[model samples]
Target: MDKIRNFCIIAHIDHGKSTLADRLLEHTQTVADRDMQDQLLDSMDLERERGITIKSHAIQMNYRNGGDEYVLNLIDTPGHVDFSYEVSRSIAACEGALLIVDASQGIEAQTISNLYLAMENDLTIIPVLNKIDLPGASPEEVSDEIVDLLGVERDEIIRASGKTGQGVDDILDAIVKRIPAPKGDPEAPLQAMIFDSQYNPFRGVEVIFRVFNGTFKKGDAVKFVNTGRTYNADEIGILKLEQEPQKEIAAGNVGYLISGIKNAREVKVGDTITHVERPCEAVTGFEDVKPMVFAGIYPVDTTEYEELRASMEKLQLNDASLVWEPETSAALGFGFRCGFLGMLHLEIIQERLEREFDMTVITTVPSVQYKAVMTDESIKWVNAPSEMPEPNKCSHIEEPYIKAQIISKSDYIGPIISLCMDKRGILKNQVYLTTDRVELTFDLPLAEIVFDFFDKLKTISRGYASLDYELTGFRQSNMVKLDMMLNGEKVDALSAIVHRDKAYEWGKRLCEKLKELLPRQMFEIAVQASIGTKIIARETVKAMRKNVLAKCYGGDISRKRKLLEKQKKGKKRMRQVGNVEIPQEAFMAVLKLD
Candidate 1:
C-alpha cells in the first residue's frame, strides 16, 4: 500500500495535461514506444479530433525507483468546464493531483476552480509549469504566479515541457515522493467505490473502481449498495493500456470488473461495490451531478424511439452526469428531456449519439431549469419552456443564477465587462491577480450564458479569457416563455424562456432566423413569436406561385381578378392544413439568432 500512489492531472483546457501524461507514461515505460501517441490517455476519436479530453481516463503505471518498485495510478482528467464532473470523479478516487499550468498562459479560471476542488477533497497538489517548450514560455513569471496561488516554495514548482519530454522524470519522482499512498485495510470487508464506467457491447458493462478495503477476486459475487443488485464478477483485472487480467485485486489498488451485467442502468457511477456475503459498511460516494442545461433529444425518425432510449442508457453508463426522463413534444413527438452540464456538453452528447450509436437525433433549444412560484406560494420547477406556467397563474419566476469567474488579460477587461453586462451579468468583484492578468466575478443568469456567451467572450478576448462558473442558486427575474408559432400553431420545440426586457427583440430575431431556415412551401408561412396571445414579432415566407395566369395570357381584367381570387382562396386553404416541416438547423438557429 505504501508504494501505491493514486493521482490525477487537472488543468485548464489545452494546458498540456494530456501531453504531460503521455510523457509520464513514456518515462515510466507504462506504454511501449510502438504503442505511444499524443494524448494517449484520451482514447476516444472525438477527443483526439477536437483536441480535448471529454472523459477521464485511468491507467496503471509501474515505476522503478532505486531497488524498489511503485505502482502509480494516473487518471488523466478533462480540462473543459463542461466536463468538470469527470474531473470531480477522478479527484474522488485519487489521493493527489498534478496541477498543470501553461507556462505561457499562466493561471486561468478553470485552473483555479479545479485546484479549489482538489483542495476541498484534501488532495495533495503538485504544481507543475508545463509548455516550457513554447517560444513564449515564461517559467519565472508562471512560477511566481504558482507560488502566490498555492503558497508553495519556488523550487517546489517543477518546470516541464510535455512536448520535449523535459522534467518527466521529476514529475514521476514527485508523484512517488509527494502524493500519499492510499489507506485501506485488506482485512476489512470489501468496500470499493466505482468512479467511472464504460459500456462494452460484447462483454457487458465494465466497471472501473478503486478498492478501499478487502479484495476483489475473479468470480466474487459483488453487490452494488445503491442499487441492491448482485452479480458475479466474470473477470477482474488491473488497467494498463489494456486490461491485465488478475486473479484478484487487493485494497489500495484500482482495477476493472466485468460481471456480464448487460443492463447499463444496473451499474451506477459513485455506487459502492461490496462482497455480497461479507459486505463491509457502504462507502461514501461522490456527490450527485447537477445538470446545468436541459434540452429535449428526439429521434430524427420517430420509429427509432426505443433504440434511442437504449443508446442513451448505454451512453449514460459511460457519462454518469447525463440526466434524462421521458417527455413528449407536440412537434417532435416522444423523446427524452435530457439534462447536461452546459451547451458544449449537450452538443458533445448529441454528436456522440450520432457517431457511436448510429442514432441521429434532433435536439431542441436548450433551456435552464427555472423556478416558478405560484400565487399560493408553491414553487414549481420548469425544465422546458412548455412547462412554464401562465403569467396570470404564477406570482413570479426565478431563474438559475451562476457565479461566473472570468480570468483574462487587462487589455480586454473593458470588452469582457461589456460582454458580460450584455448577458445581464452584474459585476460582483474584480481583482488584479497581477498587473496584466485580471480575475472578474459576476452574478449572471445561467440561461444568459447558455448560448453564444462563451463564444462571444472568446471572440471579445481574442481567445485570452477563460471562464468557470458555479450555480449560485435561483434568483427572481422578470422572465417569460417566448413561443415560436408557424402557420398559427405553436412549436413547443422552438419555444424558450427569455428575460422580459429582451423578449420582444429576441422574438423578432428568432422570427427572422426561422424565416431564413424554414423551407418555402406552396402557401405563405407566417412565422410568429408570441407571449401568450400577444404576437410580439412576425415574419412571412411568401408562397411559391406557379404563374396560374400563364394559360390565360390575354385575359380580361375581370378574368384576371377572378383567377387571382381563386389562387388566394387556395392559398388560405393550404395555409390552414400546411404543417411547416421545420428543418433541423432551425432548432439550432435559435442559439445563433443574435
Candidate 2:
C-alpha cells in the first residue's frame, strides 16, 4: 500500500493532458516502443479527431524510483464543462491530481473548475506547467498565475513539456513522493467502488474500480449493493493500456472486474461491489446522472426503428449517461427523445449511432430545461421545445441560467461583453489575469448558449476565448414558445422557446433562413412564425407559376394572361397539400441558425 499511487491528470481543453499521459506511459514502459500509440488512453477515433477526451479511462503502470517499486494508477479525464461530472467522479477515485496548464495560454475557465473539483474532493493537486516547449511559452508568468489561483509554493510547481517528454520522470517522482498511497484494510469485508466501466459484446461488462477492503478474484460471487444482483466475477485484471489478467485484486489496488453481465445496462458506475457471502458496507459515490439537454432523434427511414433502439441499447452500454426513451412524431413518425450532458455529448452519440451502428437519424433542436408554471399553480420542468406549454396556458416560464466564466485576451473583451449582453447576460464581475489577458464572469441563460453562442464567441474572440459554465439556477424571463407554420400547417419540430423582446427578430431571421432551405412548391408556402395568435414574422415562397399558356401559339397575349390567372387560382386551392412533403434536410434547417 505504501508503494501504490492513484492519480489522474486534469486540464483545460488543448492543454496537452493526453501528451503528458503518453510521456508517462513511455517513461514507465507501460506500452512497448512499437506498440505505443498516440493518445493510447482515448481509444476512440471521435475523441482523437475532436482533440478531446469524451470519456474517462483508467490504466495501471509499474514504476521504479531508486529501487523503490511502485504501482501507479492513472485516470485520464475530459476537460470540457459538459463532462465535468465525469471528471469529478474520476477525481473522487484518486488521491492526487496532475493539474496540467498550457504555458502559452495559461489557466482558463475549465482549469479553474477542475481545480475547484479537485479541492472539493480533497485531492492533492500538483501544479504542472505543460507545453513549455512552445515558442510562446511563459513558464514564469504561468507559475505566478498558478500561485495566485491555487496558492501553492513557488518551487513546488513543476514545469514540464508534454510535447518534448521533458520532466516526465520528475512527474512520476512527484507522484510517488507527494500522492499518498491508498489506505485500506485487506482483512475487512470486500468493498469496491466502481469508478468507470466498459462494455464488450463477447466479454460482458468490464468495470474499473478501486478496492477499499478484502479481495476479489476470478470466479468470486460478487454482488452490486444498489441493485442487489449477484454475478460471478468472470475475470480480474489491471489495464496496461490492455487488460492483463491478475492473480487477485486486494485492498488498496485499482483494477478491472469482469462481471458476468451480458448487456451494458447491467453495469452501474459509481456503485459498490461486495462479496456475496462476506459482504461489507457499500461505498457511496455520485448521485444518479441527470441529462441537461434533450432532443428527439428519429430514423431517416422508418424501417430502421428497431435497429435504432437496438443500437441505442448497445451504445448505452458504452455511454450510460445517454438517456433515451421512445417518442412519436406526427410528421417524423416514431422515434426516441434522447437526453445528453451537453451539445457535444448529443453530437457524439448521434455520430456513434451512424458511424458505429450504421443508423442514420434526424435530430431535433437541442433544448435546455425550463420550469413551467401553470395557471392551476403547478410547476413542471420541460426539456424539449415540443414539451413547452402554451403561453395562454402557462402562468410564467423560467429558463435555466448558468454562471459563465470566460477567459480571453483583453483586446476582445468588448465584443464578448456585447455578445453576452445580446444573449441577456448579466455581468457579475471582471478581473485582469495579466495586462493582455482578462477573465469575465456573467450569469447568462443556458437557452442562449445551447445553440450558436460558442460559435459566435469564437468568431468574436478570434478563437482566443475559453468558456466554462455551471447551472446557477432558474430565472424568470420574458419567455414565449415561438411556433413556425408552413402553409398553415404547424411544424412541431420547428417550434422553439424564446424571449418576448427578441421574438420578432428571431422569428423573422428563422423564417428567412428556412425560406432559403425549403424547396419551392406548386403552391406558395407561407412560412410564418407566431406567438399565440400574434404573427411576429412571415415569409412567402411564391408558387412555381408554370407556363400553362406556353403552347398557345399565335393567340392574343390576354390568352396567356388568362392561363396564368387560372394557374394562380389552382395554386390557391392546392395550398394545403397534405402538410407538403418536407424533405429530411428541411427538418434539420433549424440547426443552421443565423
Candidate 3:
C-alpha cells in the first residue's frame, strides 16, 4: 500500500490537463516504444475530436526508480465548467489533485473554481506551473501568484513543461511524497466506491471503482448498497494503461469490474459495492444531477423516433449525467425534451449520439428556468415556451440571471463592453490586468448568455477573450415570453425569453431565419411572432411548384403516380396549416440563427 498513489489532474479548459497525462504516461514508461499514441487517456473518438475530456478515465502505471517500484493510479478529469460535477466525483476518488496552471496565463476563473473544489474535498493539492516552454511563459511570476492567491508556500510550486518533459521527474517525486496511500481494512468486507462506469456490449456494465476495504475478485457476488441489486462479477481486471488487462485487483487499487448486470442505473457513481455476504453502507454524494438547460431533441425523420429512443437509452446507460423524458410537441410530432448541464455539454452529447448511434436529430432552442406567477397566486417553473402561462393568466414572471467574469485584451475592451451592454448586461466591475489586458464582471440575464454569447465574445475579441459565469439566482426584471405560431397553432418548442424592448427585433430576426430554412410547401406558410396577445412580426412562405413533370420518362407513370400518392400521403401526414406539409426542418430552423 505504501507504494500506491491515487491522484487526478485538474486544470482550466485547454490548459493541457490531457496533454500532461500523456506526457506522464510516456515519462513513466507505461506505454511501450511501439504503442505510443497522443493523449492516451482520451480513448474515446468524441473526446479526441472535441479536444476535451468528456469522461473521467483511470489508468495504472508502474514507475521504477533506484530499484523501487511505485504504482501510480492516474485519473484524467474533464476541464470544462459544465462537467464540474463529474470532476468533483473524480476528485473524491483520489487522495490528491495536481493543480496544473498555465505559466503563461496566470490563474483564470475556472482554475480558481476547480482549486476551491479540490480544497473543499480535503485533497492535498500539488500546484504545478505548466506550459513553461511557451514564448510568454512566466513560471516564476505564476509561482508567486500561487503563493499569494492559494496561500501556499512558494517552494511548493513545481515548474514543468509538460510538452518538453522538463521537470516532470520533480512533479512525480512530489506526488509520491505528498499523496497518501490508501488506508482501509483489507481484511474486512469487500467494499468499493463506483466513481465512474462504462457500458461494453461484451461486458455489459463495466464499473470502475477504488477498493476501500477488502479484496474483490472474479465470480464474487457483490450488491450495490444504494440499489440493493446483486451481480456476479464475471471478470475483474486491472488497468495497466495498455490494451491488455491484468488479473486480481486488490484493495487500495483502481480498476474495472465486469458484472452481468445490464441495467446501468443500478450501479451508480458514489455507490458502494460490498460482498453480498457482508453488506456495507453506501458512500455519500450519489445525488442525481439536475439539468439546468432544457431543449427539444427530435429525429430528423419522425419514423426514427423509436430508434432514437433506444440509442439514447444505451448512451444514457454509460452517461448517467444526461437526463431525458418523452415529450410531444404539436409542431414536432413526437420527441424528447432533454436536459443538459450547459450548452457545451449539450453539443457534446448531441455529437456523440449522432456519431455513435447514426441518427440525425433536430434540436430546439435551449432555455433556462423561468418563475411564473399565475392569476390564482400559484407559482410554477417554466422550461418551455409552450408551458408559459397565458398572458392574461400570468401576474409576474422572472428569469434566471448569471454573474459573468470576462478576461480579454485591452484593445477589444470597447467591443466586449458594447456586446455586453447590447445583451442587457449590467457592468458590476472592471480591472486592468496589465497595459493590454482587462478583466470585467457583469450581471447578465442567463437567457442572453446561453446562446452564441461565447461565440460573439470570441469574434469581438478576435478570439482572445476568456469568459466564465455562474448562476446568480433569478431576478425581477422587465421580461416577456415570446411565442412562435405556425399558421394559427402555437409551437411550444419555439418560445423564448426576451426583454420587453428587444422582443420586436428578436421576433423579426427569428421570422426571417425560419423563412429561409423551412422547405417550400404546397400552401402558404405563416410565421408569426407574438408576445402574449400582441403579434410583432409575420412572414408567408408561398406554395411550392411540383417538379415531377420534368422527370417523368420510360413509361414511369406508375412511378409518377406513386410520387403523387406519396406527396398526397405526406400532405395528409403533415399538420394542416391552411394547406401545407411543414417539414421537420421548418421546426428545426427556429432553433438556430442563419
**Candidate number with greatest lDDT:** 1
What overall lDDT, based on C-alpha atoms, would model 3 receive against the true structure? 0.81
Cα lDDT for residue 161, candidate 1 = 91
Give model 1's clash tally. Answer: 0
C-alpha RMSD values across all candidates: 1.0, 1.8, 6.0
The residue-by-residue lDDT of candidate 2 on 1-594, one tens digit each, is 888899999999789988899999999998899998888888888998998998888889999889999999999999877787788878878999999999998989899999998998789999999988899999999999999998999999888987789888789989999998888888888999987887676877778888988888888998999888898887899888778998798888889887667766667777899999988887864666777788899998999999899888878767768888898877788999988888878878988998988899999877888999999999988877778877678998898898999999999999999999999998999999988889999999988888778889989999889999888888888888888888777888878888889888889988998888778887788999988878988998877776687699996999888988888778878885535666766666776666
- Measured by TM-score, how close is model 1 to the native structure? 0.99
The order by descending lDDT is: 1, 2, 3
User: Arrange candidates by TM-score, highest first: which order?
Assistant: 1, 2, 3
lDDT of 1 by residue, 1-594 (tens): 989999999999999999999988998899989999888988889999999999999999999998789999999999999999999999999999999999999999999999999999999999999999899988898899999999999999988999999898899899999999899998889999999999998999999999999988899998999999999999999999999999999999999999888998898898999998997777774799999999999999999999999999999999999999999998999999999999899989998999999999999999999999999999999999999998889999998999999999999999999988888999999999999999999999999999889999999899999999999899899998889998889999999999989999999999988888888899999999999899999999988998878888775888988999999999999888878888999988987787
TM-score of candidate 2 to 2 decimals: 0.96
Stretches of candidate 2 off by over 4 Å are 556-562, 569-573
Better of 1 and 2 by lDDT: 1
Residue pairs with clashing backbones, model 1: none
Which candidate should be chosen as best, given TM-score against the real structure? 1
The lDDT per prediction is: 0.93, 0.86, 0.81
Better of 1 and 2 by TM-score: 1
